[model samples]
Structure formats: structure tokens, C-alpha cells
Target: MLWRAGLTAALVCAIGLLPWLAHTDPALTVLKARSAERTPAPETLRAIRDQLGLGDGPLHLLAQWLGGLLHGDAGRSWVSDTEVLPAVAQALGASLLLMAGAVVVAVLTATAVCARTLRLGARRRLGARGPGGTGSAVLAALPEFLVASVLASVIGVQLEWLPALGWYGPQWMILPALALGLPAGAVLGRMLDDLLPAAFAEPWALAAAARGVPPKSVARQALRRCVPGLLPNLGLFVVGLTGGSVAVEQIFDIPGLGRLTLRASLAQDLPVLQSGTLALVALAALVALLARLGVRRLIGPALRDGALHSLHRPTPPAPRVVSLVYLLLLAAVIAFGLPRDPLALDTTARLQTPSAAHPFGTDALGRDVLARIAHGALTTLGTALAVSAAALLTGVLLGLLPRLSGPLVDTVNAVPPMLAALLVTGIAGSGPWTPALAVAVVAWSPLATHTASLLRQERATLHLTATRALGAGPWYLLRHELLPAVLPPVVRHALLRLPGIALSLAALGFLGLGAQPPSPEWGLLLAENQPYVERAPWAVLAPAAALALLGALAVTAAGGARLPRRRRTPTPPPAKPGPAQPPATPGQPHPARPVALTTPTDTA
Candidate 1:
């Protein structure tokens, strides 16, 4: 709880200090927003500064803002001069509603997916191909923005099934909710599927089945046991939904907190930004608290009685066929995309359909879509791989140091990548590096936590202890023992996370926080061509397909690595001298020789 409070405080403090840190004058932004045509004189700037309390230092402003927050006063927006509380409150309410709807959808979707797997009796081992298979992987990998754009284009624009934009009524919420929920559902469902087999394999579950308990009842009980484990993840999913809604809200034009905070940050509206940051951090903390409580309540007694068994198992290797297919697809994309020049322009050929002359069509600027996507493969995939590799190395190193684990990991993990990107953009200004930097900041936590855990476990093993006692230096032990044990799993974890990192980078781009225009980064491409969807749907679909394929390939490859077989220590040959003692006594058991008990100090 203290850690959560500190995290919230730190984030709020950082948000308060953004204008100063960025070395930008908030007054100028306000002035620009108010009257873009007029230049600000010295006197005008001074008047605006005084009105907005810019003369005060950041510490002073932060203190005052915190005090006001305690008394139900959230200060006033610099741009609108309106009470920050009401605007923040309204936006928070909309965001909460959207999140709530998404949760319901996620839960239902997960349940359905899990049910199908359970019904088929496909209780695969951990890390093996799950029941949902390729379809679920594709769904899980699809970014919310891409999903929202497609839904908006096809279902909203073409089919006219629902209101594509706005937040006028509950009906208007459907598309945005679906966009956020579907991918999340796929993820949750996949997690549940991974967990269910272990639950079913437990002794109690086996006993119930042996006793002729109804399969449905046993499945229900098994699912209940698994839910506690998933609670923390579900909490994270909720927090992620909040962060992810930035793009969703933008696509749907909803006045949610994500959109509100983004607008406030870009405009340097400190009051609104501070309030929104508070709301987001508070929401994350509260959800985490609730999840912790729920897990405790559900598993407390079982834990006390030692009734619950560990759900963790070594992940089985993915099928060879999956890996081969993924490689082929990846190779095909690179082979087809790399040779062409992405920058060539021909205005007369703009928005042309896919043909022998122009393979992925042209954009509004007459830039070849195929060229951009092919070139974007280098930018997006290369950056993601580089970031993941750096993060993996950093996480492993940090994880090896026991002092750096625990609360720090928890605190840092609470901040989502999108939120971090917003903070980074506020301080450093957006650029191609901004997204990568922000992602790298938050990406190391999970790997660090994983490494620290494995390190602790390995340190407790008999062989490591023996090796340490036998005068093995720290570096030697790490090189021969710990690193070998830790690196493989951590690498696998890093590989699994590569898709998410790529998605986050793309998301930042989609939100205009990454790779500016004409860069042809995948996310930027999607953003640039969104308006042309009605005229040329191919522009949007091309990049989205590429991103989805990239995600699928990464996921497949990560899961395909073969599990290493456990090595066994050979037993020492029995002492030949025992035969002499064995001859001693049929009745008297001989003169019992004093047996010496010795601890084995040899590491090998």
C-alpha cells in the first residue's frame, strides 16, 4: 500500500514538473490555443503568466495543487479557465463506463473460449499449442487501434451497423467497447486456457473426477481455482484497457480520460493533466488493491492449509510446423518488401489499386503502399527487436541483484507503456526515439522480476550452495550456473513480449507520439491513411495486416523453442568394502561400526 501511494505521488509529481522539465512556457501554448493568429507581446505574456500562476516554482505549484485536491478543488484549466474537477470528473465517468463495458465483454469472451477448450477435453500442457490455436493468436496480437479502425471502416462506415463515432448514447459505446474488449478477451482466454490444464491435473480435481463428479461441476470448481491466479493479471488488463483506450477514444472520438489527458499533455494544460494523471494512477492502484484483496479472499484458507498446488510448469515446445510456417511468412514479407524504394512519389498515380505496376497501391501523396510497408518493416521490426534485446539484457542484469527486486518492480510495473510514453513525450518531446525510450523504460520490469525469482530459486539449490562453499567466486558461479539457468527462460519471456512491445510502439505512433509524418512507420501509416478509408481501404489494411503478421510471427517463434531436457547427476558406485561388513552377522549384526556422516562439498 505504501509503495502504491509512493508510485502515485511520484507520477503526479512528474506530471506537475513536466512544463518546467520540458523548458516550455505554458502561457505561450495557452495563448496559441486562444488566438493562434496573434503574436504574444511581453506584456500579454506576463498577464497570461500571472493569470495561470506560472511565476510559482514547480514545487510550490505542486504543493498548492495537492492541497487543493485534498479539499475537492482541482484547480482551473489553463486553456479554458474552467474548473478542472468537473471536466476531469465527466471524462473519468466516460472512461470508467467504457472500461466496465470492456470488462464484461472480456470476461464473457474469455469464458467462451475457455469453455470450448474444456469441452473438447484438450487439456494441453503449459507452453504447448493452446486450443484456440492460430485464430486466437491472431486475435490476441491485433492492436486495439487497428481493430478500432477496421471496425470503424467496415462495420461503422460501410455496414452502418452502429454509430461509428461519438458518445451520445449507450448505442454509440458498442464499437469502442468491442474494439478494446476483443483482443483483451483473446489474451485473457489464452491465459485461462494455459491455466486450466494444471487445475484439472490437481489431486483434488482428479479425486472429484474419480468419484464420478459431473464434468461440468468439476470444470466449474477447476475454473474457480484458476480465477484467483488470474486476478492480478485481470487487474493489469483493466489498467491496460485504460491506457489502450487512448487510441480507441481517439478513433471513436469519445471524451474519455485517455483522450482528455492526451489533449491536456499536448497543450501543457497542467491542471487538467495533473487531475487526469491522478485519476489514471489512482485507478490503477485501486484495481490492484481490489485484485489483491480478491485473491486473498479466494485463496486465503487454501493457502493456510497448503491445499493449493503450484500452477507453474515448464512450457512445452511449440510444434516445428508452426515455426517453419512463421519463418516462411516472415521471409516472404522481407523478400518482397525490401528491394523497392519506399520514397518514390507519383501524384498522378495516387490511390491506385493493387496491380502488377503498383503492388500495395498508393497513398494520398502517391507514395507506394508496398514500398512504405516494406520499408516500415525495417523501422518497426528492427526497432522492436533492438528494444527487446536491450531490455532483456538490462532486466537480466538487474534481476541478478537481489536488492533491486521486489517493491521497485511492483511500483514500476504499475505504470503502463502508454502512460510512460505520455510522460516521455511531455518531457523530451515526441520523436521516433520517444516510443522506443518509453517502452524500454517499462519493458524491463517483467524480465527483472522473472530473473530475480529464478535467481533466488537457483541460489537455494544444493548444487549452487555446494559450489559456493567450494570457493567459487561470484562471477564464476554466475557464468557457469546462474546465467545458464536464467538466460534461456528470460530469453523466452523476452521473445513472448516482443509482439507487445511492437504493438505499443505502433500505438504510440498511431497516437502521434512516435515517428512523425512521411516516416512511413507502420503505426504512422495507419494514422495517415485513416481518413482515406472510405476512398481507399487498402491503405489502412496494408499496414494493419503487416503489423498483425509481425505479431503472429514473433509469438510463434517465441513459443517454438524446444524445452531442454533435465540433466541427471550420476550416482557414485557403491563401496566394495560393504561386502566385508555384510559377512559379519546373521544374528549379532557384528560389532556395529560407527558410521561417519559427511556433507558433500564437491559441486560436480
Candidate 2:
């Protein structure tokens, strides 16, 4: 395991080096002047070389990176003349302060939502989709951007309790972190929400609960039972949170790696950009590694073997419930999309003389805002689904492959999703497809790792082995053995990611790198109307509301959809035995005709 982790780290580091390596050529672009700063003067270099036993070549890179690792000496900053160590150190400190609070906010809120969702039995009313697991659906649809805008408007703009656009004291981190963490946390909650129910339904849980244990106790026990399955996800979750740092830090300006990356991009400082990107990747890797180790330690031995066989048992059947769910989804898409004029009648419209002829009323563009909103819903939801589906497929393929733990997987995993995304977009040049593709590409790896890890872990279970032993081919194994075992969690995770993807895409759009003008993306809309926040507010609110509604729907769908309970059939009792005696009864019966043996009839 240590070796696995070390390999993972090395792979991560190597992947993290790609951007830096792109700049390693001396003749490349305009960083020639900045390269000199990375190393000391010749005399100082020689002195340091002598002190460190450097024979130059590629050896120095290792020495430098190693030294940087231990003492935080990450070479030099490109834009700021400050030492990379101190500059990032200060920035990281502030980032951590914010992240700590953000993580807490994310965990608590997500856990609360997950708990409520898991307990909600029916999913219809929970989301905007008209009940029945709609909460997660709504959450997923709303995205973090929507949440951010809403909070920023309600709490920051209207109430004026907090500044709408500035990052100030610790209190400022609250809303920003909530914005950043809520969606992610809700996504995390989905992982728990799916697995926890299965745990509760386990034979062990039943045994525990049959003794009159409280539901809360059953849930904890369920949590305990689900530990091994949840461990890998926990690692992935923490790391992904680290990845999200870019947007959050930028929003709050806490000087973290995220902000640095943004600064790097804006200045086109290759070195800064590379360093900042790699720093985030490394941080994410470290967080995941730590979480992985922690989970392993906590899983321990006794429980490990015990848990191995439980979930490994042959899957009962696919819940027709999910099929019902798909039908419901189809119905929703139609209803939401089909409505060309659902809101025709309005007294407000009649009074204002904005009649049915206008229907959705006129936007500042004189186009129908309602039509645009509906179309925008389809566009946004469609984009989200496309991106999410692509990500999910990519993540599953990469993650499920045993090779995921290898060099390539490690490397891919090591590359921060955001950086990878930017790299792809930068290379692909400008287009809506580029961003969408970039979003898909960036989103795939983490999801893949997550999927693969779950499958790999599940691979060790007795049920998997048993199915294999029963002459199941690899395809059969995948269909009969693997798919059923892993699908639920994957579905949950995908649902969770739905909102994040939308939010990230919108954020990219907001930054002017997403969809081009007139695309009507929520983020672009926000950017379009950002100047009007103090005035009309509707322009900003309209799109922000759309993004929120979408994220909220996705989240509620993912986190709130409980795995349907498997009905247990009653066990039949064994037949009862006839009572009493008879060894002597045989002889007595022989004598019965002669008067009941010894004591009978008058044996007297």
C-alpha cells in the first residue's frame, strides 16, 4: 500500500511537471529573462552545487524539487519578485484558513442534506422536478455559481451585511466558502447517501437493528459497515475540493494556489502559471494521499476481512425503481422543454398591458425572455448532461482500468483537473466546443479514479470471486459481477458532479473564456449583467436563478435518491419432531395386546 501510494505520488509529480516542462526549453517564448532568476549567480550556484553535490544535468531538477518539497523552496516567482517560498507560504496560509472553514461548511451542509435525503423515503417532492428525490436533482442543477450569486445577492447585496464583491475578514469566507463547498459537499453527500442505505440493509445491520437499536445507531453502524467503500471516495473528495480552490480562491482573493493560478493566467507568466498549476496538483495529491492513508488505518484488519464478503454477495437485481426514475427524468425533460407557453395568463401582465402576445415579456433585447429562459434551460441542462456524461464515461474507463494505479493513470490523476482543462482549452484554441470538451476532459479523470477505485476495491470481495468461480467470463463478470456492484455509487457520484460541472463551465464562461457572446450561459449572463447588480439586478438575477435551479435539481437527484430497500423474504421453520418415548414402547406395544407391557392393564 505504501508502495502504491508512493507510485501514485511519483506519477502525480511527473504529470504535474508537464506545464513546467513545456517551458523548460531555453529558446521558448518570452520567459528567458525569468529563467535566470530560478537559479542563483554562477558563484552562488557553484557554492550551492558544492554544498549540495550537484553534478548538473537532470539531477538538479530532482535536487531542487526535493529541496522544495522539504523546505518549501519552490524556486522563484515570475511576476512577484518575492521568493516563491514566502510568497506561496503566505498565500497558502490564508488559503488554508479559508479552506478549513470552507471544508467545514461543505461537510456539515452536505451531510445535513444527505441525512435529510436518506431519511426522505420518497424522492418526488425533494427537488424542482416535482417530488421524489428532487432535492438532489435540484441541488445538482443549481451549481455553485447559482448558489454564489443567490447568496451574494440576498446576503451581500440586499441585506448589505456582507460585501457583494470583496473578500474581507473571516466572515467574508463564510458566504464564499458556502458557495464553493455547498455543491461539492452535496455531491459528497450522494456517495454517502447511496452507500449508507445499502449498509443499513445489510444482514449485520438487520441483526443490529432487530435488537431494538435506534435508527441513528443503525445509521452509524451502517456508516461503519460502509467504511471501506467510502474510504476511497473520501480521498477523492478531499482532493477534488483542493482542485476547486481556483474558483473559490479567486472569488475570495485569499492568495491561495487557486488565486495564484488565476494571476498566472492573466499575466501569461508561463513559469508562474506552471508553478501555480503544479502546486495545486501537488496539494490535491497530498490531500488524497493523506485521506487514503487515514482510511486504510481506520479500516483495520478485523473489519476489513469481514466487510470483504458482505458486499461481495450476488446482487439481487436492478431496482426497477431506477428505470422508473429514468422514465421520470424523460417526463421531466419533456414537461420542462415542451412548455412553449405555460405561463400565458398573468394579472400582472394584463395590468401592465404586457399581454399574451408578448407571453414571456420582453427582455432588454426585445426578445422573449421566457422563451430564452426555457431554451436556456435546455441549453444549460443539455450542456451539463453532455459534459457530465462524457466525464462519467471517461472517469469510469480510466478509473476502472487496473492501469489506473499505474504511470499513466497516476500522471493523469496528478494533473489537476482545472489545469488539464486549461491546457486542453489553450491548445484547442477558442470555441464553445473547446470549453465543453475541456470540461469533459478535465472532469473525466477524477471520476474515473473514483469509479476504478470502487470497482478495484469491490474486486476483492467474495461475491466478485464467487461469480468468477461460477464460470463467468470477463464480459459476464463485468455485467453480472462488476456492473451491479459499482453502478449505484457511480450514478450517485455522477449526479453530484452534474452541478459542479455546470458551475465550473459557467465560471469559465464568466471569466470570458467560456461560450462566446449571445450564448446565454448563466455565467456569461452574470458577466453581461454584472454592472447592473446595483440597479436593475434582474439581469444578473435571471441567469443566476437559472444556474441555481439547475444545480439544486441535480444535487437533490443525486444525494437524495436513496437505494430502494430489498424486501427480505421470511424464513420457513423446520418440521417439529414427535414427542416421547418408544424404545420400550415397541416392546410395550407387543405386549399391549397382552395388556400393555409391564405396568399396563393390570400388570396389576
Candidate 3:
């Protein structure tokens, strides 16, 4: 555990060096930012380098930074020239307070939603058709930024229920908490909905119920069983709280670490950025440690022996209702949802809020928000689908081919996806294809690794060997046996990749590397509307809501929620082949063969 924590710390430090890779001379960028009027001369660059000890190698720099960190010195901000630790200290309390509130809100929301879901249809699978499932899918789809904007607009501006912006009374925290917590709650609820049913179906649970145990008591036992699996998500939730609230902080004008980090990135304040990265990573590491301890305490011996895989796989699904819902959503967005000319400007109505004339209102440039979102849906959803398809196909091809060795695939999987995406985007240059290509390049690694593993396992199966012995060729085996066995899981994996691809596209777009202006991509909309959020919050909220919808549709279509891991027993070995015997006629007696019963002494 200590070594794991140390590894995480090392990873965080390594990540901090990525910016330096992007900018070969980060000192130049910093120096240039300090004085924009004059280009940083060679002399000025040398002076800056000497001041920061920039001539030192990467290891030396890392060591120096680590030493400073241990001494409670995070150096000073490049832009503000204030001590990084002090500045972060000022913001840390606010972020931690906000996160605590968010955690509580998320827990309550998840519990209520999941309980209701379980009560409605405990036996039936949770699907998009169910209200709880649909609502969760929708909520889970929304990114923090969009949720924050909508909350600000509806709760704060229109209804006057809460303050639109600022960190003031407890009421201010409520809206931000809701924005941060609701989506997280939805994710947790969805996971619970998937997990609880399996727990209820366990043999011990069934036996308890059969013995006239109270329903509530039975439920408590089942839920207790779920604790081990669910605990990890809480750690993830904490990590999410540390990093995913940047948009929330920005929208609400809260003095949180997220807001500070965003501001620092924009200003190119290296010290603050590095410090913020380390702080978030440290928080994540601490949460991971706590989660590990909590699991050991809560789960105990069960944690060690719990089955890790399921042998009784579900039957292949037919076209589900969720598929139709996705189609209908796309059709509706294209037909009734879109306004006239999404990109066209109307200077007269610039910066307008939601009104009868324009349902989603107008942007700073007078472009209809509804129109842009409706059109952007096609681009965002389409790109996600394309990238997912490309990745899945690539993974399948590579996995199926015997030429690609396990070590090579493992090496590819070892490369961090984000790092790969950055490298691809850097080489390719920013364009619409950047996000899709970057995602495809990185996403294939996982699918290929999983597919290869599954194929190897399948190859070892007696049935497949028997088929091959019966004169089946490689193509026949691949097409008939391997395809049927591998297709279901592979398809599920592809579907799961869709939402991630969309999120990646949005992230890249936020960094100005995805779909450019006039494209109406959701990420582009978020970036373009940041400055106008005060006046026309609808512009930001509309597209953000659309992104969430698209994400939800993708997830729902992919089977709504992840299924819990089931306990597996080792498969018994296949029977050995016996000597051939002459076949007897139907309904006729066959010749009896002499059989010898042998003991250990008889063999001797």
C-alpha cells in the first residue's frame, strides 16, 4: 500500500512535466507572459533560466520540487508572484467545504433514487423504459458545467430561489452542491440499481427470505454485500470532486481550488498549476488509501474470497427500447428541435435570454442557442459514434490476428490514453478529426487487450478444440465459434466507449483543439459562451444540456448501467477420450467389454 501511494505520487510529478514537453522552453512562455510588449531576448531568457535553475535535468528538477514540497514550500506563482502554498491554503477550505456538502447531497440523492428504483421493479432489469433509469441516464449524461449553468439560470435567475453567483450564505452552497452532486448521485444510483438485483438473487439472500426473514432485514444483508464493490466508487467520487468541479466553481463564482486551477492554467502560472495538480493527486491518493482501509474493515474475509467473474453470461440481447429512443432523439433533434440556420447571426437579438422568440435564447453573436445545440448534436454524437466504431473495429481486427503478440499489445496498453491523445493531437494539428482520431488511437488499446485475452481463453476451451479437430479451418472457427462468443462483450465494450469519446471530445474542445468556431460542437459552445455566461447564461446551458442528453442516449443504448461482478468457480476439466468401440444397432444389445476394477495394489 505504501509503494502504491508512492507510485501515485511519482505519477503526479511525471504528469506535471507534460507541459514542459509541450513547451520545450516553458521559461520562454513564462517570460513572454511577464512582459508582452517586448519579445524575450536571449539575455532575458538566460536570466530567467538562471533564476529558476531551468538548466538542470528533469531528475534534478523533480528532486528540487520534491524537497520544496516536503518543506511546505510550493514555490511562487509565475503570474501573481505569491507563494503557491499560501494561495492554495486560502482556497482549500472552500473547496473541501463544497466537496463535503456535495458528498452528502450525492449520498442522499443516490439512496432515495436507488431505493425507489429497487421497489418499483426488483426482479426486472433496470432499462431506459423505467422512469428511474431514464432520469438517471439523463442526469448522469450532464457534465458539471452544463448542470451548473442550468441551475444558475432556472434556480438563481428566473425563479429567484438562490443567488445566481458568489460564495455567500449556505444557500449559495446548495445550488453548487446540487449541480455537483446530482450527476454523481445519478451515476451511483445507476450502479446501485444494477448491483442490488444480483445481491437480492444470491443464494444466502434467497435462503434468508425463505426462512421468513423480514424484507427489510433481507435488503440490509444484500446491501451489506454490495458495500465492497460500491466503496471504490466513493473514492472515485472524491477524486471527481477534486477535479470535476472547475466549471461549477467558475459558473457560481466560488473561490474554490477548481476555480483557482482554471485561472492559473489560463494565466500560465506554472507554480500554481503544478501545486494544484499535486494537491488534487494527493487528495485522490488519500481517498484511495481510505477506501482500501474501509473495504478491509467493512468487507473483511468476504473481500478476499468474493468471486471475481461470472461464468453464466447473460444471453445476447435483441434490439432494446433504448435503441429506438436514441433514434427518436436524433430524429427529433434534426426535425422539430433545430431552428433556421444554426450559424446565422441576428445582431438585433444578441445576448438575449430564453424567450418565446428563441426558446433557448441567443448567444453573444446573436446565434440561436437552440439551433446551434440541435445541429451540434449531430456533430458531437456522430463523432463519438465514429470514433467508437473505428476503435472497436481496430481492436477486434488486431485481437483476432494471430500475428500481434501479447507482449506488444500489453506495451500498447501500458501507454496512458491521455498522453497518447495529446501526442496524436500535437502531431495532427487541431481540427474536427483531432478528437476522433486521438480517441481512436488511445481507445483501441483497451479493447484490443481485452479482446485478445478473451480470444486466448476461448482458444483453450474443449469445444473449440473439438471443432478444430473435426476439420474446421481458422476462418470457420473465427466466423462461427469465436464471433458468436466474442461479439456480445466486444459490442458492450464499444458502447461503453461512446460516452467516454464524447467527454474526450468535449475536453479537447474546451482546450480549443476540437471542433472550431461555426462548428456548434457542445465543447466549443461551452468555451465560446464562458465570457457571456453573465448576460446570456442560456447559451452555455443549452449546449451543455444537449451534450448531457447525447451522453445519456449513448449510455442507455449501451445497456444503461454496468453490471456487478459475479463469483466464479473453476471449470471442471473435460473428459479424456476413450478407445473406439463398434456401434450397436438401435434397440439391440451390444457386445460387452471386459472391465477391470483396479486399486492402488492392483496397479503395483
Candidate 3: tens digits of C-alpha lDDT, residues 392-510: 88888886863452333333332333344555554666676887787777677556645654564456444666788899999998876676556555665466446546766866765
Q: lDDT winner among the candidates? A: 1
Q: How many backbone clashes does candidate 2 have?
A: 44
lDDT per residue as tens, model 1, 440-497: 8888876786676556545655567678889999999887777766675567557756
Note the clash tally of each candidate.
0, 44, 1
User: What RMSD does model 2 have?
Assistant: 11.9
What lDDT, from 0 to 1, does candidate 2 have? Answer: 0.55
lDDT of 2 by residue, 140-203 (tens): 4554544676777789878988765756676777887787667666655656555554444444
Cα lDDT, all candidates:
0.73, 0.55, 0.65
TM-score of each: 0.82, 0.70, 0.69
CA lDDT for candidate 1: 0.73
Candidate 2 lDDT trough over 10 residues, lowest sum: 595-604
